[model samples]
Target: MQIRRVLAATSAAVIAATGLVACSSDSSDSASGDSESSEQDGPIRVGTTDAAKKAWAVLEEQAEAAGLDIEIENFADYSTPNQALEQGQLDTNNFQHLKFLAEYNVGNDSDLTPIVATEIIPLALFWKDHDSLDGIEGESIAIPNDPSNQGRAINVLVQADLITLKEEGLVTPTPADIDTEASKVQITPVDAAQTPSAYGEGTPAIINNSFLDRAGIDPNLAVFQDDPNSPEAEPYINAFVVRAEDADNETIKKLAELWHSPEVQAAVDEDAKGTSVQVERTQEELQEILDRLEEAERNS
Candidate 1:
């Protein structure tokens, strides 16, 4: 979408210093703006966490060939991208899944919506000393502390039989919901970024795929992981997100659809090391899933 040009030529150095990379120079004058009245003539300022991945380069090339301009803004943490998108600093973002998006929208009273389904990266459990989930009774396992991911991590433990929840079929089980006496291991919640370090410190951790690559841990070495193809994994399907007002923008939709291009998909596969399960869902289907998740979040 065409946004107001907020950054002048002099700010390019500062933007680069903060990790915002422009995928194309054609729309250098276009950066940030109001989503309501703008046309799709300028660069689509897209925010993401994995901007360094080669898939972005491929997608940029594909978008250029398709007559669309996109700018990639990189954020260091998971929380900032959506906030940026909500604040109108970004035209769209593709960093989080529907569950996380639901939590953000419900918690903050925002209406950021998903436009296209991307891929589901499995959350895996890894350990430094143990090769299998055997004989690890009484030990503690670290999990992500964020609301959405923490629940998924708890589910991973439940699937591994290392822990059991007090209630059956809880969608987002917290550590408090764990049946401590009945469970084999204790639950420790930490920041998502520190999970690998927790693993390095001799604790078993359910690490997100983003941290595994940078930590030099092999995805194949994960002792256990949730099944991406299962029905329970529906909420974890990542997608391109935008404000509710811009959800139907044709240019943004076209840009989001480019993620499935053969060249871009290949780059994504190479970057994910065969661990990512690509997902396809219509915008209506995705909105329905998000609605259900948002209802759950509200009820919780």
Candidate 2:
């Protein structure tokens, strides 16, 4: 997140060069030291985009029992939490997966680190008025159109043997990757959030767990889903992230521990309602996946 401050200052300089007045701030010095005090007397500000406050009540209670003040800040957008963490506004965030964090770091030239692996929310293929994949063989299927999720949608289809990507080991595959002649379903790329509503007779779609929850759709209705235990699911595994310097911090480590406890696991299960699988990938394995993702990002 050191790079956030640098980018801001760089923008200010550019504005000044263009004969524009630039606002200034005196908090840069203090921002750099904020993470160091996350576990001190002050409360630890945890960032998340999901139902962390509602789903992780036991985590809060456990942290309180351990004398650690916890503040869960729920974000509507995925990008802001990382920006906040980088600028020292948050001690750590728990919303994004390895590939997402890797892309953020690569795009911003920062060294944000993933300290723990949490759960793998599978993007499942669901259909309306159809019970099986074969019933919707020649139908048009909708998938997310975004760069990050589009590949994920395609992967689900590929696993179902409905389509095949032209290249293997793609981190983010667009519709271009699909081999049209070989594919059984006609791939229709739509907004990720729109996939849930796109389903009907002769129409199937890949729906992400988050969006499906928001739309009140049941994931049990899915015809196909990616295997969470497979190595291919590594990139989509979510984690707790922090600035690289605070990777060894005791508070963050304890928080990760509390997340994997039985109470928290029960909460995750209750909240997910069988939509996602809870994963307990080790810290070393997480870093290895992150490194591999970062390498792939750089090459891309």
Candidate 3:
């Protein structure tokens, strides 16, 4: 895949650039307190887990050409970016999907909002021993144990016709929801980081895209994946998020829209290794999805 080619050619460059910023320290001071007054005070601090990706550099260049200054802060893990943004340390972040954001918002009593849709990096089912879903029956599959990804992994199995859920239309179904008597395979929930290892252990696994590169798994080798364009996949769409008060800020909105620029999008496509399916949802539509997810989280 193109991801392999990019990694081989620019792994060193990526590593070097990755050192540019560590995760920002937590602060008791709420940065959101002064957000409105300081909206244009300095470079728009945009937090991301993929700061080393070529797309950020291209995005910076494009934003500069358009008279907007953006500073990309790299976070080592998934939990910090929104925290940084909520605390007023960052003007925006572009690392998580709507479901993840909803969980964070509902859990923390925060109102970080999605400004625009970016792309969906598909969660795919990989099997080392089986060439197709038909090759496995009454066998076990490993899925992510985290709330956000586990539900999606279960949905992937359902989509592949390997499992049947007891009820339909669940936003985040768990293994307990599966009808074991009717299903083709049982599931073993494991840490998201262990899915590739589970695959190596000769069990079929549904792996997240972020773990694929480091595990030396080719995305194209996956036997099945959820459809990114489907209505069921809306919650998984990643976006550039900001504090709710700044959702309509012209500069931040423009910065979010800049992700669709040809140069930036091309760079994103290369960095994603062709797993990213581009999505273009209006801000209102994105918020609608987020609201539904937040409601689901509250109910869950």
Query: Backbone clashes in each candidate structure, one number apiece?
Result: 1, 0, 2
- Candidate 1, position 1, lDDT: 28
lDDT of 2 by residue, 100-163 (tens): 8888999999889988888998878888766677767777898888777888888888889888
Each prediction's TM-score versus the true structure: 0.87, 0.85, 0.86
lDDT of 3 by residue, 1-300 (tens): 000011112232453455333223432232434444434545677888767789888888888888886677776677777776876667789989999999999999999999989999988999995667777788799999999999999999999999999998887998889999999999999999999999998999999887887688888889999999889999999999988878767778888899999899899888877788889999999999999999989988
lDDT of 1 by residue, 1-300 (tens): 222223223233454467543445533333333345446755788888877888988888888888786777777667777766765567789989999999999988998999999999999999887789887788888999989999999999899898899998888999889989899999889998899999999999999989988988888888899999998999999999988878777788888999999999999999989898899999999999999999999999
Overlapping backbone residue pairs in candidate 1 total 1
**Span of 10 residues, lowest total lDDT, candidate 1:** 1-10
Return model 2's CA RMSD, one decimal: 6.5
lDDT-better candidate, 2 vs 3:
3
Ranking by lDDT: 1, 3, 2
Worst 10 contiguous positions by lDDT, candidate 3: 1-10
